[model samples]
Target: MREVRNKWVFKKVKVDVFRVVRRVEELMRELNDDMSVAGEQEVCSEGGGRWLRPEVGWVKLNVDAGVKEGWGLGIGAVCRDSEGAMLWGMTEHRCATLEPSMAEAEAILVYMNKARRRGCSRIVVESDCKVLIDALQLKTKGRSDFYLLLDDIYSICNDFEIVL
Candidate 1:
C-alpha cells in the first residue's frame, strides 16, 4: 500500500486545485456581470428615458422652451454613459426669429447638427413639442413662414440620426 503521508499530500494537492478552480469560476461570473452592464448606454430626458440595452448605442437629445418667451428657444441635451450618468449636457438659446413651434424645431436642429458635427452617428431625438414631431414624421408639404423654418429643420435630419 502507498505510504499514508504520500496519500495525505496527494489529497492536499487536489484540494488546492479545486479551491483555485472555484475562485476562477467566481471571478468569471463577476466579470460577466460587469461586462453586460458596461455594454449598456442610457439616456434620460424630459419626455421619458431611453437605454441602449445591448444592440443599440446612440446619443439622445431633449429640447424644451426657456423661461423667457420671446428671448429665443432653449434646448437641453445630455449624453450619457453606460450607467445612466450624464457624460455631457448642453442648453442653448439660439439667435433666430422666434415663433414657439419654429423655435422648438430650431433648437432640435441645432442639437442634432451639433451631435453630427461631434461625429455622433447614432442618435435618439426627443422633444416636448408634439406638433413639430408630428410634422417631421408626417413629412408635410408646402410652407408658411413657420413651415419654411420647419422645412429647414427637417432638412437637418438628412445629415444625421434623429429620433423623434
Candidate 2:
C-alpha cells in the first residue's frame, strides 16, 4: 500500500510540472509577440516627432506613475531646463491601492505641488497620460473616483504659468 501511494504522488508531481512548463511556454510566446508589435510601432512613430526642450528661462516638469499588483503606486518627476540640465527630481511611493488613472492623477498633483514649493513659476508639465491631460485641458471634472484629484490638479494649475 505504501509503494502504491508513492507511485501516485510521483505521477501527480510529474503532471503538475508538465502543466507548469506548458503554461510558461505559452506566456513566453505571447510576450514575444507583444514585443515585436511594440518594436514596430516605435519604429513607425519615431519619425513623427521627438522630445523638444522647454523654452528659455522655463523649466519642464515631467511626471510619471508606476503601479504594481500587490504593491502600491510610485510617482516620479524630473525638472529640466531648456539646456537639458536637471534642476530637480523626486519620487514618492504611496501605500494606497489605486487604479492606473487615479495613480496618474495623484502623480500629477504631487509633482505640481512639489514644483510650487520649489518656486517654479514658469513651468511646462508633460505626462504620457492622455486622459489626465485632456481632462486638465478641457477642465472637465470627471465622474470617476478621480474627480477630487482632477479638481486638485486644476486648482494647482492656477498657481503657475503652466504649459501642458
Candidate 3:
C-alpha cells in the first residue's frame, strides 16, 4: 500500500479512470482510518486530535487492534521517529477470535517487545482503545479477569521508557 502511494504508482498510469479513482479514494480512506493516531478526534491538533511528535530520540508507536465477528482479529502498529520518518510498520491476522480488550492488550505488548528489540529506548505508544489505555495508566492491574495479561504487559513495559 505504501508503495502504491509513496512510489507514485498512480502517476504511472491512468486505467479505467473513474473506477481507479474510486478505488484509490476508498483505499486512502482506509489507510487514514487505520493510522488511528488519535481516537475520536481530528487528525491534527488544531482540530483537537493528537498525532503530535515524540521528543527527539524518541519513537512514537501507533497501534490498533480489532476483532470482527467470525473473522478473527487484526493487529497492527507503525513506529515513527521524532522527525516523522518511518521506523517500521506491521499488521497481523490472528485466526482465533478473542475479546476486544485482550486482543488490544496483546497487540500493544507485542509492539512494545518489537520496539524494545528495535533499540527504541524511549517511546510514546498510542492506541485507540480507551479501555486498554485506561487500564495501562492505572498503577495496579485491578481485579479484572484479564489481570494476568495486564501483568505481562506491564512487565515488558519496564524494559523501556514509555509515554502514554
Residue-pair clashes per prediction, in order, are 1, 0, 0
Per-residue lDDT tens digits for candidate 1, residues 1-164, read: 12332453455333354765577467545534654666544333223544342124665565555434444445667554334434455777565557677667767777677777778766666666888888878877666876786777778778765566
Q: Which scores better on TM-score, 1 or 2?
A: 2
What TM-score, over all chains together, does every model reach? 0.59, 0.68, 0.70
Comparing 2 and 3 on lDDT, the stronger one: 3
Better of 1 and 2 by lDDT: 2
TM-score of 2: 0.68
* Candidate with the greatest TM-score versus the true structure: 3
The 0-to-1 C-alpha lDDT of every candidate, in the order given, reads 0.60, 0.75, 0.75
lDDT of 1: 0.60
Instruction: Find the 10 residues in a row with the least total lDDT in model 2.
Output: 39-48
Query: What TM value does model 1 have?
Result: 0.59
In model 3, which runs have C-alpha deviations exceeding 4 angstroms? 1-48, 143-145
Candidate 2 — which residues are off by over 4 angstroms? 1-49
The TM-score obtained by model 3 is 0.70
Residue 100, candidate 2: alpha-carbon lDDT: 82
**How much is the lDDT of residue 148 in candidate 3?**
74
